[model samples]
Target: MLVPLVIGMSAPSGLEGGELAAVVARGELVWAADQEGGGPHVFPDPDAPQRLTGFEVELAELIAAELGVKARFQQGQWDRLPLLLGHPADCVINGIELLPERRRDYHCSRPYFAYGLQLIARRDGPLDTVETLTAPGPAGRWRVGVLTGSAAELFLRSHPELEVDAIGYDGTIDSLEQVKSGVLDAALMDDCIFNFYADRFAGLRAVGRPFGGGYYTVLTARDTPRLSTAIDEALGRIIADGRLKTLYDRWDLGGRQQILALRDAAEIPVATRRSLRELAIETLPLLLSAAGMTVLLACLSFPLAIFAGLGVALGRLYGPAWLRPLLTGFVEVVRGTPLMLQLYAIFFLLPKVGLALPALVAAVAGLALNYAAYESEIYRAGLKAVPLGQFEAAVALGMTKWQALRHVVVPQAVRLVMPPVTNDFIALFKDTSVCSVITVIELTKRYSVLALSTGRIVELAVITAILYLAMSWPLSLLSRRFETGQEQRP
Candidate 1:
């Protein structure tokens, strides 16, 4: 059997120096994912690809370099990483907590970094500190926004008596936006994240002190001991030599000394980290569920496109001349516009026009309609490619026009169109990422969400791209088979 691949290492934050060095020395490659807006692990750097750069990137590269391997990165939305584990990456980096439930499924590295939640509020807001918000009666009802899947979010969820209105946003920037716009009275995030935003977003400040110590550990496959050991050693070395601190300073995270101090104090025992294999195991099921949606959408939409394209082709080719223009116009409009725009219009805008559809239906409809237009052209070309001599031959044989066209013209036309039509479906499958914007929750959307949550953009994106390739590769084989069959036809 092939040696099981060592795929990912979920870090506490985005790639910083240590993680990158570890991967480099071990000759292990890594894929990094990041949030849509900068998360503690991931951030938007104008110079980076897809506008993402952060601790995750630096650490992932360092680890990869230490391993003598390559480091790649990706961008995704938060709240989706757990669902993307195993399918797209080996594990995510960033201080992922080792919960009892998660421990059963995932193996975790020794704690590398630690931090705590910080409450932030606008300069002119009502509450300045966590204590005031926790103080007396009605004031406790003040809304607090927290990025979903963060430690702060989990803390808020566990304490219902606090009476804080908890809103789960996908990114720190979004949570900050709610606070800045006065939509939320305050927001809670990691101290490093709060500091990053407080400086970038004017009129916002970190209030009171940080709360609840949390350690950051690398999450990986529960069964992969060799991979886990390699990464742990790399991380340990990086921490010992002060490379990790260099990264902290580079990102201006050195200012959060207290946060780092807490991490050092609460370090989880090495034996405990080793015992946490179960945490990584459950991750696969969740990721597979999301991957299933991706496959389902692609499969369902493709057949619909074939039928819709055929109908459209018939209309354009055989319908009345006046009707042809209308059919042609419809195809043109769909083909001309971006599929992403179509998905949004169908999912978000169409509901306003009294035509509401579920997110999945809208996604399927948008993809099918978009591909049908391209398919129609392929079909039309196929029809036109049928020689006039075939019709003449049919007439000479005393066959009816309908019978001749159906038996002779269509079969050949279908054979001719098969390749291009197949190509269109492959393209459509990849393009399904656009549906993620409207919450269709397909592969791309899942990857995007996972990236945002874990700040491992490169890894998530690579897995997503691979998933697309896996789907397309089979379709390509089928297309080639059809082409071979066509050639063999008597």
Candidate 2:
């Protein structure tokens, strides 16, 4: 088996040093961004699906030009961008806030942009400022939305009274959309982002004063002081040359954050290191909720996969001749592609064609469809193992083909396939973690955010492994029991 060299205690990009010279030598500066971080920042160009266009995309190009290297884009989920920096990526620049935890592990550039949180609400909505909503009235409790891991979310999470049902979304667009749809009372995010995205959506208005501001900086690993310096110098040059203002003007983002970036850089606050015990106390409920989501996904997907697999197998084996080829191709096609791509197609692409599904539904459907392909093959093998002679004898005994296969052939085949089927089920259990790409938060996404925020990687990881093990071990034991019983048969 091949093992990844970068796994375990691996340093962040540049932490080993010389990240700047290495990018120049390679003739490419790999900048990581989550295009799903959404528009006005980074997102797909609707006019041209193959192209990407956003304020960040243009800013990256300017930075790369200053450094004399071609800029290359590497996409990662917004929450996972920091973790990706040390791996092949040189840095992350996608509206990443200068959080305290980031400063401890990463060396960040001077603040390129400063932004305050904007309160987004329906036009003529009852809620306004924190004061109006927090006071005793019919509006005392309101459902608000925030982007997960943003300062807005942290602020809301920090306030128990002000955040009655603060809905967390993976991106600014998702949260803002919820507000426009009346699914949420309001949403909060960078004021600049709200001005760019919310205005176009209609029925939503930015109200109340902007609050809880933070700096956006490019993040590099701690090992490369030179790379960190180079990034700061590049940003300084960008600001001095008025190129930064040009980009911001196009995006209509001029504010105190951009002003601070133009003047002397803001003094970044030193990070207060968190203790493991504190992290455990804070993260316990988060992990438990995520584990519940993981279990929910597993329970929901496996049964659907089992039924879908059964149907596809029967179609391949006993259906009409013309339909058999179509079923065969579907099984082959789904199995041939990666599950991640399938989920992306369902969650992101489907909405364009007017088949927008809720996150949970899309996640379950994607997992079930992908697993059904593999499960179909397993069932097919079992059906073949029943032998042609059994079918002939059952027919001779005056049983119709459907009746014979259902009662005798299928029953025997099911026993033959139980061991492999159980193993596939276990594999399916782990794969559910990928559903977070579509914004369905599960155990893995929760662990990542907690690990980055709490800075208790080793402890959280061990507990997470135990959580996964606790889920899978029982199934493994049951699988072994069936295998042993079969072997012991006379």
Pairing residues by index, what is the TM-score of model 2? 0.82
Clashing pairs in 2: 13-86, 15-223, 114-257
What is the Cα-based lDDT of residue 66 in candidate 1?
A: 58
lDDT, each prediction? 0.68, 0.80
* Residue 39 C-alpha lDDT in model 1: 52
Show model 2 residue runs off by greater than 4 Å: 1-29, 43-53, 61-72, 119-146, 162-171, 174-187, 198-200, 207-209, 240-243, 255-257, 260-268, 319-333, 336-338, 341-358, 392-402
Candidate 1 local lDDT, 1-490, one digit each (tens): 0011113333332233354344446455645365564755776676764566778778877765655676665444445454344445545675465444345446677666667788998897777667776654244477787765667877887787676866655557756765675656788887877776666778888888888857666776554456666777877787767788888778777725733563456434333322223423523354567778877888899899888887789788887799899989999899889897888678656655667665679889988998888888888899889998997898789998767878888788888989788887777777776776655556655554444444445544555566667778999999999889888976
What TM-score does each of the candidates earn?
A: 0.52, 0.82
**Model 1 Cα displacement at 26 (Å)?**
11
Supply candidate 1's per-residue lDDT for 89. 55
lDDT tens digits, residue span 1-490, model 2: 0012225336445534577788899888888998877878888998997788898898888888888998899998687677676677888988888877778878888888878888888886777665665654364567677777778878887877763666667778867765665556788788878877765878888778888888888987677777778878998898887888877877778643486554755566768876677777789888989999999998999999988998899899999999899999999899889998899788766765667776789899999999888888999999998889999989999999899889889888888888999998889888988887666778877887787677566677777878888999999999998899889974
Give the distance in Å from residue 105's predicted Cα in candidate 2 to where it truly belongs: 2.7
